[model samples]
Target: MNTADKPNPAQPHSLSANDMNDKLSGDPISNVLLARWIMRTHFEQFAGSSVADIARAYIGVYSNRPTSWQAVLARNHNMDKSEALRAEDDPELVRIPGMRRSKFLIPKSMANMVFGATCLPLLDHEWRLREAELTLEDYLRIRPELIRFASGSPVRLEEIKSFLGLSGSQARACTTVATYNGVLVRAPSPNPWSNRWLYAAAPSELMHSHDALVDHEQLQWELACHYIEQYGPVSVEDLAWWMGISKKLARLFLEKAGAGEIESGLWLGPLQKKTFESWATNVSESSDERVRFLPNWDPLLMGYSPGSRHRSCLGLDQIGAYDHAGNGLPVVLIGSKAVTTWRVTAKGSQRLLSIHLPDDILQKDQQIIQEAAVMWAERIGAIYIP
Candidate 1:
């Protein structure tokens, strides 16, 4: 399990629009990622207050705290904005650096699992070590000192700097060392919206110890199962990209977990095939017309890599849903296709939303979009500027 050797990033291997149309033509499941939306409902079902359920389903969602949770729950469960916002304090969920070394809100049960599978291996690479100018011994030795002040309570980076009399770069480097080694974690934001200033705190027993022994294969296999169950009919390339691992490693995890190939280069976990087929049979063309407003970094938008995004972003090639670096943006979805991107900004004490749409959108659809946008704005205490 030595992950020292960085594998070359794989080229996109997912089916293109034409290839998918020709291959699964007229198949209900082939209806441009609509089935994925339906299949996902299978996992999105949970009590309104159960943030852990949502966290477990997506293998941890990007932690913009409750904004990300609220947008996702509003679409899937019709959850109230206040109810979703309360999830920020749900003890069942813990924030950790998960896939891609990004802060993720995950259920406590899987906190260590994700930390082991994704965060621990960070040490095996030399890049961060080189950037920090610290050797393995140096990194480990510095961890305890860096975490001691923030161990029991959340402390801001600035506070750490002032207390330690370290410069900004030195403080960041110290925290980076602590975080990469799993000693420190990004703390909850005081509010739901801004991440401009963040707190750092030591991980609870959920993450246990930085140097604790872990079963890497078991952790990775469990993650592979979760990915397939939640976002499957995915390509190895998609899995690799999502996990920020190489395709060889991704394929090895998939193979070890006995994932099944539904189409060339596309796979589902062995146990997921039957359930996926059942869900696919229930989705109809009418389902394609459903509209949803997904927040920036929603799992659906981040579920697949560049090659497989066509599943949800069909006909959106001209209007990209993600940035140049592949980070997802707030999107307006009609069925599974992204029709536009949306942004929200503070206006006085309220918020203003602007939905960016293509000129070709139909009048009727525009009306629907407006209505949906207004309703979403009301839920968030925002005004939609048409």
Candidate 2:
């Protein structure tokens, strides 16, 4: 009696392409959210000593200020009423307010984020402002002292130039680039700060690679990766438009990344226009009419264009921008389209989430929106009763 072991005779042999996609992205949070996860946990995780916190504090100072390493030394003196910057002048320096140490050394403590880690620098800079008494607007003005950034605090992304070690035309160029990447503001020169505010720090984290460092490359790569990962069995051209890459570069990059079509002989996006092809066969016909609550800078809104750049995958009408300054509303995506908008408001200790729908929302879909709003509130830890 020869008994052969069959391949898991009780279970199905293999999953189809659709099944595989569903498994990976069942509760899919787009690539943008995934990037945040990588920033906090992988690329810029606080692995080293308290030195990481030090680096973060100085990163904010240098990126937005005009002072030099030497000037910083002088400022240290001025801060201590000059005379001298003895080790103990601040033996009680108290770790720059960003930390709780009373005997922290400025230079040694400021190394974790200065080297290679990208987000570390940003996290530190933002936190430092939390300790300041100025408003973001005051910090960026000609006189930070006059601005009252302390109405409760310092300006964050808008004043990133206070960090770099650059000057002249190069400084201006850096300011522009930083602004584009979501750095709030850029100053031409520095005053009490320093002139090192022109260049960019490492972006969110160690982005994917290659073009990731380049201007639009990382965003482009992200767009492509997102499309394929979420809606694969698609084409390269479909990705290119979503990514805003040149057709030629898009093709080259896709090929370089070693992506292949499960279906042969055709691509989408930039290449499809020339060859007349589509990735229809790979998509699932049954898409949920679920209303997803998304942030203002959500990946789809940022990447996809109304032009023929991308396939009309989602029907978004009037994409609403969520205010970073204000507690914003969640954009309502009915099915795969952005139909209307809604937001939750807080009055005193009570909170209210509101929605404005265009078409008649079904009883079930409305329930989804309501539950989603509740979940959103819970994530933000609001004390809403109903």
Best by lDDT: 1
Question: Among all windows of ten consecutive residues in candidate 2, which has the lowest summed lDDT?
Answer: 1-10
Query: TM per model?
Result: 0.82, 0.36
Candidate 2 global lDDT: 0.34
**Candidate 2 residue-wise lDDT, 169-190, digit = tens:** 3334333322332332222232
Q: Number of backbone collisions per candidate, in order? A: 0, 43
> What local lDDT score does residue 40 receive in model 2, on the 0 to 100 scale?
24
Cα lDDT tens digits for candidate 1, 296-373: 777767778876744443544446778887877777766445578888988777779889877897776677778777
